[model samples]
Target: MSRSPEFVVKSPAMDIVIHSLSDVGPDQRRRLCEGARGIFWDTAEVKDFSSETEREGFIYKYFSYYMEREPELFFCAFSDHQVFGYICGVADTRQHQELYRCADHIPLFDDLYGEYPAHLHINLAAESRGKGLGGRLIEALEGALRTTGEAWGLHLVTSEGARNAGFYRKNGFTHEVCRGILPEEPRMLFMGKKL
Candidate 1:
């Protein structure tokens, strides 16, 4: 696995370090993964789970899928030995489409596979928001993909009209399209950026 150079961002009170998950030890990796799950559940826009089973089902689809399938693409932010945020993605959405459709039951984004081949998901702890860690995570993932030269661009799907849409826009993702998975589901905003 290619390792991203460890980056340390200094804040007024402490130092936050960004590390490629592939470079971390097993213990640290486990801790970061646990922390990431907590952050994902807490910060997720679709958190109106009625049961633990429902919550775990969403976690399996959105968070665990990437960590289990493409752990090399995961980047994490840590401060004082605690994980506060992470970014993870796939290099090719076409490959992800096949796996997701068969394994996770997620509908394919086939229409976008040709132009925007890569896609990402990011989440930050409540205390870590507004600190620019989200942007750093995106940059780290972009740098990793650029090294591989396998993707033309990146895309992400988020809740339509959500507050984070502006955040993605600030990071250079443009609204490409809006879609709904099922008749009962809310609309999803598809955003893309040339890498």
Candidate 2:
């Protein structure tokens, strides 16, 4: 794959840089993994963990696992060398299907895999929220995906009433499917947007 462009988002607080995972060092990745703990700290997924280690593992599964397969599609947002958040996915989902299939716990359905081809996941630190940074992350992710090889669009699995659904819709994605495992609510909704 050719090199992807980087972004510099100006803010009164700091200048946030958005780029591929490789651009950042291991320390940054470590800090990211650490700060990532805060992203879902309050979510049921992590809260249900019986131990701290299990909670950490849950974070790693959704955040870092994809980086192992497609670091290029994993975009990181940083400021003063500190990772604030990221938007990463499989530009070529075929490369990571086996890993997803073999997982002990599957977050998504088998047939739903890669329907959007280049699905993404995003998260930001507390200080980084409410600054329109989330949209910027998606814009950068979409921009990079468009420059690469054929990728229909990006898809993300999020449940109804989750704050993220609003951001996804505001960014132009439509609710394509809702797997209702929560009775009247959707266990998960696949949100997609064509590039």
Candidate 3:
């Protein structure tokens, strides 16, 4: 599906169109993830898992699951026919329950999603960074949430020092919790924003 191109208020040079992730093919998903990895690596949020093979594996699993099971909840931003950003959220109570069940095996899963608001994960490629695509993405997600009668507030967890905390805060998210290691590794920053 296509969307009307709209200019990002933060960067007039860029025009973005947001669409559901299901509308794209594997090749497009690969391109989107590649661009996303560039930004993730540059920010040093994901590095312990070395090699492109491992990285792609992680993305493929997560995104493939998202597309297959929750296509309507994921979105991709495009410009000139290329994916420059993406956002995905989980609003289904059943999905959230499954997350809690899976998290029972992981040490901190309980604290992360426990008593948390409905939310999603959003990311933009480095080339598309600092252009207000982030805010636009969240706005689009909020629109989707409104249609479903889900809560207006959304939450996210990201590793500290990712430099994305500020970006999220600027868009509307606020810090809710911070824990873990320091210097290089640390717990994620739990953030939330009210729609």
Candidate 4:
């Protein structure tokens, strides 16, 4: 990968380590993914999340399913032995069916912005927001994806009015498409950036 194996970032609170998901044990991996759910998949989105067990399962399925399946393409932000955020990516949108069969259900950009051969999903804990760490996470992911010779760029889908479009644009990603696939879910905006 074009990115370093690991890097230390000094924030006002602590020094955070950004590294591959494989660097941590199973327990920590689960912890990190679960910890970021509040920041990304808020409890308000899950109508039936009345208990911890119910909420955990919904979050895991919606957010960390790919993360649990693909460790190599995932990166974690760790500080003081806690996960502050993470970015999970796939090098090829077409091959998602190979890793997880439900790719058919996901919104497709392959027909439009097909040149961007990679995609990413990012989430950061509340305290970690606006610290410039989110941009760093995107750089780490872009660098890692670039190492794969086949990847020309990356794309990601974010919900409309979540106020995250600017973050992607700030990192050089361009919004290419916006659509709603399911009646219950918010419209999605697909953004892409060339390597």
RMSD to truth, every model? 2.3, 3.2, 4.8, 3.6
lDDT of 3 by residue, 1-195 (tens): 422233343346665667665555777766665554454455444456778787765554434446556666677787655667777777643355545443322234345444445667676777777767788888777777776766656777676666778888888777467666344655766776666
Candidates arranged by lDDT, highest first: 1, 4, 2, 3
Measured by TM-score, the strongest candidate is 1
Better model by TM-score: candidate 2 vs candidate 4? 2
lDDT (Cα) of model 3: 0.62
The segments of candidate 4 whose C-alpha lies over 4 angstroms from its true place after superposition are: 1-4, 25-44, 47-61, 98-105, 182-186
Q: What is the C-alpha lDDT of each candidate?
A: 0.81, 0.70, 0.62, 0.71
Q: Clashes in model 3: which pairs?
A: none
**Model 1 lDDT tens row, 1-195:** 664667677779889888877888899989889888888878876768899988777777677878888887888899867888999889997776545654322343567868888889899998888988889888888888888888879988887788899989999998468777776877778889999
Error of 1 at 24 (Å): 0.5
Q: Model 4, range 74-159, lDDT digits (tens) per residue?
A: 88788755778878777787776643344432544557447776888887887788988999888887767766565887888777
- Which residue runs does candidate 1 get wrong by more than 4 Å? 46-53, 97-99, 102-108
What is candidate 2's lDDT per residue for 1-195, written digit by digit as tens? 434777888999789888776666787766665554456463334367788887667666676686776777777787764777777777655557564654432345446555666777788777788888889888888877787655876787777667778878988898467676446654677788888
Clash pairs, candidate 2, are none
Question: Which whole-number lDDT from 0 to 100 does residue 140 have in model 3?
Answer: 74
